[model samples]
Target chain A: MSNQEILNKLRDTIVTQDIKGCEAAAKEALEADISAFDAINGGLAVGMKIIGDKYELGELYLPHIMMSAKAMDGAMGILTPELEKDKTTESIGTAITFVQQGDIHEIGHRLVSIMLSVNGFNIVDLGVDVPDETIIDEIKKLNGSKVLLAGSALMTTSMQGQKDTMEAIEKEGLRDSVKIMFGGAPISQKWIEEIGADATAKNAADAARIVLKLMD
Target chain B: MTNRMTPPERMMAVMTGQKPDRVPVVPFVLGYASKVTGISLGDFYADGDKCFEAQFASMRLHGYEQTPMYGYASMGAFEFGGEIEYPYGKGQGAPFVKKHPVETIEDIEKLEVPDFKKELPGAYKQADRLASRCSELGLPVSVQVGSTFTAASVIANTSEFVSWLIMEPKAAHSLLDKVCNMFINAIDYFAEKYGAENMLPFDGGPSESNTMISADMFAEFAYPYMKRIHTHLKELGVNSVLMHPCSDQNKNIPHYIKLRNEIGWSGKYVWLFGPETPVKTQVEAFGDHDIVCGNINPSLFITEPYEELLEICGQNILEGMNSPSGFILAAGCEFPPNAAPIKLMAMLDAAEKYGRYE
Candidate 1:
């Protein structure tokens, strides 16, 4: 197949959420002399980009997003090793991310984690129900002089976990070294200020802009 | 004058575009009440009497005007042959998906509209028992039925639901049609049990905001099904429907207001929880034709100090105060189940102190 054909095939296969189809098409791309980077950027990435846009447009739904994300992951499983051989980009910085301790709703923060990593940032996704101490400990272990700490809490009650994490950052005397940001159903600029968070984000796209600006 | 209106009268006043005796205190508190009543999360969901008692105790204990219906996410969803896994172990958060019943698009075609008495016996009992108790006390019976999309989302999982919208639009409509049928039946049941006049027909779910879908998507999926429910009731002469969408669903506010217009909600009778929509935009869209509640950040109840909580509440009231239809002070969404007692008390108390109209 031609270069354009392989890329089109890759996009179509992933959109169907056929795992085997993705693997085969992705393999076919590599066999067709399409660079692994081109296969990902042109094919798999294009599928997810459409999914993300459609989701924002409300043309699509959350299940489609999960499926698209899954498809992207599946394609990467077959292509990452090949792309890694000639990769040359360095991560921008480390972002310490977690859903605040006791908050079960996690898709909000997990998406931000994926965006940051995809944008070439070293992402430490601490996962859900993570406590403050563990956050501080992760930042410490990173051995970085500066880091970004992100917390997400969907429940009004669990938002306290964001504040607690902030307090822990201060209690451990790491206040000056960290930038804390939060997002969730309940989070707002007013609440962010009241809780002493450095910033608040609406979604992964907004988060990337905020994180990049904060880094600068 | 606002402070002197009776609780029900005050609520009624706001619903009619009249000045309330004061700002109405209407917080959704089932989750909070369950923890306070010391019921295990599992037991709390499983038992109807306990659910009713918890809500009754919360009203008695907290003293808010709104009667929060203690409904679990799974209460109605599980009635359709799905498993529900509530957080039972130590420090577990909220209940979550163990398995989605509609694993394939074909499953959507196979399922039937759930019968409340047979399919959702426990939820039906809770509703029946609570409606009776509230009726005895002359309280308007309320049931917080999530939107059909939310019901369908749980039955099939959000991932499957969204993908179905893309890969299988036919199945998506089929599932939504089934869920909507169940809702229409449940609505008729409650309307008969309690007077439909007193019923709010709260069609709540994730679609209330753009966090789930764009306005066009909501217009395609949620608007049609939700409008059907409201229209069916309106044909029976019920004119109002209250929709609760969460987060900063500002983008969809105009669309929702438009949908509410179609749903036959008018004046202060139909209220939309204004999260991020500008006050001017709200007045511009519906004028004095609708009621607006909240945009208050719910997290303050959990994490903010009293003074900040009061400040945010005051700001929300002031913003909504300028609306032509009217404003009611409520958490932008449901109060955090673990919200501080003081904050919950302060919600009503702040209205008394700051939301008074001469």
Candidate 2:
């Protein structure tokens, strides 16, 4: 397949959640001498954007979105080493992801991580149920460089942890050095304002785009 | 001169939109039961008899009107071949993803209708056993059907599930349909053997959390299944349909009320439980169309002193029983296993002191 044809096929396979088709197309794209960046940008990322749009419009559901992400991850796994062979890189900023203390809902954080990683951002995953002090400690370790400090809480009761994390960062004089983003089932724009979050997104795709905007 | 009613009688009166001597206290006591009955979490989940004994013991000890019947976080997902990890502590348990079980489009196409007999006979047997026990004890039993999105999270991982909703819309719908159908079948089987009059309470924990998806996604995914499930339960003669979605479900209250109306459940027959939804909101939105069961934060169980607990319970009774009916005092979610026994006693005492009707 031509490079363009391969990328299009890969995108289609991801949209349909054809895991095998996505893997095959990814390999074919690699063989066609397409750069890793082009394969990701022209094929996977763009396809995911379209899928996300349809989902928001009620054209998609959870299982389908999950399948598409798996397919994209599969294709990305094949392209990462090859992409590293070439030294060209895009600097899309950095994001630190964690689930708030007393909350173990990592699904949102995982989705946000996948979306940001595939869309050309550096992701530092802090895993699930991380404490506020730990987040603050991590931020201080990163010095004064601006990074997206994103937290997710699946429980309404646990959302307080997000607020506490922000407070801890502010106490450490690191709040201004980081931009905070919050999302989860209980999180809302009102919650963002209440918690003093720098930004909030309805879903993972929006989160990535918002983080990019904040970084820029 | 008047006599005091039993916990169940007091609760039933409140449920039926009639004056009770005082407000009934029905705290969510799942883990508390586990602690009281000396039953391990694994056994409580695997055997319905043990669960029944444990729940009944806990309720009897605490003088609660209701007993929490679901065990572990992943019982609903286990019916769909999901694996759950039970952590040994008072902390919330974790669910680990061993595999997707369905990966390719062909896998989706070849999806088998989950056979309860073959797949997870334990779940059905347990439900039946619990129902029988509830009948014998003359105590109402509530069965939990997990939220659609929450169930999907266990089987395919939450991130993967949300991504699929975005990237593979068709496949997502297909999976959701299958999950919903399985849940309906499970509920039908249980209701048939246990009697449809039994309360069918759904535990849609993550969906209500609202941190994972938007209100729009909830309307599209969680609401439809809830309507179908509630409708099915009502058809089986289960008039009371209680939804326990553990987060702030304030945004979706209107949708829940609409579902109740569609199911033909009267105001007194519908119950919505969550931590963030205040009793005032329930009264405002449904207007006695349903009972607002809970908003007592589980944290209070651990944090509050005995006297303070009683005071808070009394205050909640005053605030929640605005209509003198259509209100139940319950923990927002399952009470933490480690809650002070004295706190529960204080709640029951408050009910006794203030719940009596002349």
DockQ of each: 0.36, 0.14
Write one digit per residue (lDDT tens) for candidate 1, span B1-358.
3247777787777777688767777776666677778887656555656767787788778666776464544344565766666655433444555566788887877787767655444356656677777777877667655577777877776656776776777888898888888888887778876777767667676533567666666777777887787777776555456667655566666666676567655423445554565555665666557776755656667667888777777777776666777776776666777677888877777787778886
Clashing residue pairs, candidate 1? A58-B214, A63-B159, A64-B163, B2-B21, B2-B22, B3-B21, B208-B245, B267-B289
User: What is the DockQ of the complex in model 1?
Assistant: 0.36
After superposition, candidate 2 runs with Cα above 4 Å error: A1-104, A111-216, B71-73, B89-100, B103-105, B116-122, B199-203, B266-270, B307-311, B349-358
Looking at model 2, residue A2 earns an lDDT score of: 67
Please write out the lDDT profile of model 2 over residues B146-182, one tens digit for every residue. Answer: 5655665555555555666656667777877777787
Which candidate number has the best TM-score? 1
Overall lDDT per candidate, in order of appearance: 0.70, 0.69
- What TM-score is obtained by chain A of candidate 2? 0.91
Best by lDDT: 1
What is candidate 2's DockQ? 0.14
User: What are the per-candidate TM-scores when only chain A is compared?
Assistant: 0.81, 0.91
